[model samples]
Target: MRLADRIAVVSTEDAVRASVSYDQLRAGDGALYWLETRPEVGGVATVTCWRPGEGARDVSPEGFDVTSGVHAYGGGAFAVIDGTLWCVGGDGLYRSRLHDDQLELVSLGSFGDLTIGDGELLAVRESEHGDDLIAVSLTGVPDIRALATCRGFLGAPRPGSGMLAWTTWSEPDMPWDRCEIWVASYSPRGQVGNPVMLAGGSEESAVEPRWGPDGALYFVSDRSGWWNLYRWDGHQVKRVAPIAGECAAEPWELGYASYDFLDDGRIVVAVQDGPRHGLVVIDPDGTVRPVDLPYTSIKPYLAVQGTTVALIGASPTAAPQVALVHLTAADPQVEVLARSEHAKLDGAQVSTPTELRVHVAGDREVIALVYPPTASAADWRAPVIVRAHPGPTASCLLRLDWQAQFFTSRGFAVVDVDYLGSTGYGRVFREALYGRWGLDDVDDCAAVADHLLATGRAVPGQVFIRGASAGGYTALHAVAQSGPFAAATAVSAIVDPDRWAETVPRFQRAHARRLRGGAGRVNAATVQRPVLLVHGTADDVAVVEDVRELADQLTAHSVPHDMLLLPDVGHYVATSTQAGTALEAELAHYRFVMTAAAAD
Candidate 1:
């Protein structure tokens, strides 16, 4: 059952990776492909197609990057008309076409500030306070609205001739801080010609417009503090790619998001690296190149037919993969083609496993995301998993997360730690939980679970441990300090950190002053093992009355636990039936601790 063989499902785990949001037409028949997944987990987004002349390329196993928000942005989706492509996901606005030779799917609608014009399709099915109504869909589908009007649409497709231009602002202003970029002109006899603002949003921040060849507008601004690229020329706007760089790319103080046109005067832009991402390129006379590559994070799309981009770097072992590069291939290399297979020897060849970082107390360091179940350790055995991630501030930042690729493809040896108050190692490691929080995030998750059991890499007592939400209060305070872990779980958890700071709510009463600690508490005199809880009766943010008051204090001290709950969830358990109810309460408490750690 190791069929992760292309059409996309990727998980040759070493810490996951992939990202190429929308390469024209997009996914399935929309052309150029190779993606992994994410749209809140299980909307499958595994792709890898490339059809044009039919050099024959079509890979898809993933699905669900949702389609209407609330997580379904498997890069929103592209491919239009001719071959038919337009996906957002599920019952919101799908569409797939190409039939017999493949491409499947066909109808879906929900419409909102959309775009895609030429044969026509512009939108804004609904909006609020600022007032709305600006539909228009001739053939781009959506129960054909021909023209609705009240004006407020924006991209999803609506740039060229369908004339999908719009602008509006009214509350505390932040549509680029003020607003104005209207340009209506659609007429199959619907008459529209009174909207010509054509670019505004000042104090700076015009945005990623596009269409300068014969119409002249192009965009991306920072009013010149850094984001570069300008152009208006009906008598002044200037600068086309004024990039200078110490590493330019900082326009998102509040969204209009990155740049992307390539051929309308070439460009890509994202840049930053060594902290997150950096994938530059430009020209209109400023010239820039920086796409060197040890990669920090990337996703540069653009294969509209040529200039060929489709990138997606990421490294520390893996997570994020897709490459094509062909700015006209001077020496331009990078053809990875497709990887991410190991769901446990489904043809092996993973990579990302060497960030061990030990210790915890005052000398911090913790960090993790390992997965060494064996790619050679003289043929490694299994049983380890500590795992945690639940935004200890949001980042275990090492990508390819197929739920830790199903515990190292069914053999088990995951890690995913990043303790000591995690978050892309910055701002003093996200204020190392400011004050003190659960003793340096509980000795950084019991020093990444006893540094994988004093480095022999585990076998000694089977080991388990888990987390969710502040790493489920650091896996119930690392099983109440001193971690060995025969078993442990805690979905939507946060056990009694003093009633999560007095009946936690008010968006978390200041998160218990950032987890202060040391007077010690996580009781049942430091749990003995078998715990598993998994709440979610519509959790109002980590609430099942705090897992039924910590499962009645772990069943009045008998310890050995089991809870469950979940129905109409919250705090996202990330489906597959909540990962089969956390793999049947973690393999029935590790098969009763692997039959009592093989009878001691």
Candidate 2:
């Protein structure tokens, strides 16, 4: 098929979308609820429930914006209690009986981490001062009462008999950086007693606290330099099957669950090893066994009912889907409950990624997933597109990405580079870019491209780079610092580090400084290749004005470039329309640069 046809295939509304988004996995009463975003519905959060031998059903009320806006990057938006569905919506907290078609607004306010217990919804409410733990009565009365306050941030409020366990972290420290699990005594009268620290401290990061059937607190902590599971035995915490792998990810938002305890005391958890993940079950004696699964990517959202573990997972050939795996089965039965959407590509159209570990400066290593062009009969060497993933802290996994295939299916080798600061690696690796952000991330991406060239995987002088947000910053830096990249495309790129920091939340501003550093600046004059800047006017994170200023500067320096201003869009290309436009703009940029190179 033609490149345009491939792009159209991936960009169409019916294309397979990722169903297992953040904090969308919840299970109760033998049923599992998976929150999905449908382009047909303009990417609205829709809850789909599944039961044994039953078909999937849409439980969310029609036309309700059941999404959480607590931290901007929403997650932990919905939770199911005793077959009743409670979700955060625009007007406040909303509830829908699992089998009912009617919706009732229960509370009024933005909330996160909705944990159900004591006949109420306990969540972290976003207030003017900061985030606090509050209990909202499940009755339609909208009676909101504060359970805990004066904390910079609070999450994972697991309510149990006479106790409430949650995680807290102050500003200047992201959840994965430093957080503590606190367990407090609770009373029926909405009274919260003094809290006791279960695990974590200034130098340790603890998250995802939950109470088991026996009322023993369980959580994940990075005290040993890896995010591993631990059991809090009222007075002390003990490591559960300590391993070298990561059991928790960067808690960018609320409602991150790496593991859940089964009724029989067995624990079903997802452990991330580099970019791939493995589902494992741990007996009380600490005997760990891997569950048979075909997926290479698994989210932190895990729900366990008896011996069955439900998670959102994906393989190289399949988009992410809600999966139910029976742990005790002789073969570890795996069942895909709900998919993101029907995949538009056949098995031949999918590009399987080959892992690439390149040793860069000082013998330090960086990892990336390289997808070769999928043209079976192409005669010429394929061009390469090196993508710097966002969240300079986020790692690129080996999942089926339609966008990456959109390029590979059209004779372009796409490389997803996980730079120095990416997670999934240990904390030491993650903090590698602490004092060196733009420089290290930029160099790592370039290194991946250079490695591909050296190994004869890419066509020389035909390489391009593209990214959005922080990745965009790295893409721009790569062009400015060291690049003969045919062309560069940056969506909402950070032109100035200092200016970008101002737009970030106060807690994240410090990390922004670490990424940009004192000498960080985007010199338009230094850009040798053509550039394309795509931004949305509604993006408050990397405000459109900041990106526009960079585009103007590029023009002032007479740098050949193009800019696309999308109105009413946010930091992300959410809607199908926005994604289609961005994909087309990127294609145009690549074509323009290739033509210009040919002329030269």
Name model 2 segments beyond 4 Å from true. 1-23, 98-103, 341-348, 375-380, 574-576
lDDT for residue 388 in candidate 1, whole number 0-100 = 75
All candidates: TM-score: 0.28, 0.94
- What lDDT would each prediction earn against the true structure? 0.52, 0.78
**C-alpha root-mean-square deviation, candidate 1:** 22.4
**Index of the highest-TM-score prediction:** 2
Q: How would you encode candidate 1's per-residue C-alpha lDDT over 354-437 as one tens digit per residue? A: 567776666656667667653436446568777777755545555444555445555667777766545444334544575565
Candidate 2, 1-600: lDDT as tens digits: 665354333443333243224336887766877777765455577787887878898888876667887765667888787767888886577788876768887767778788778788788887658888888776656578888885477788888889988888886677777898888899654777988888878779999888888778888888898998988778777998887888987887788788988777888888887888888888889999888799999988898888788888888777777888887766988888777645445434566777889999988888888787764443335789999888878888778777677677667889888898888888888877877877888888988888778777678778999988888888887888556476788987777888877887555665687666723878888988788899888786777887778888999999898999887777776443477577778877887777777889
* Total clashes in model 2, counting residue pairs 3 or more apart in sequence or in different chains: 0
Model 1 CA deviation exceeding 4 Å by range:
1-123, 126-162, 165-184, 187-265, 269-290, 293-296, 299-370, 373-380, 384-412, 415-563, 567-571, 574-593, 596-600
In angstroms, how far off is 577's CA in candidate 2? 3.1
Candidate 2 lands at a TM-score of 0.94
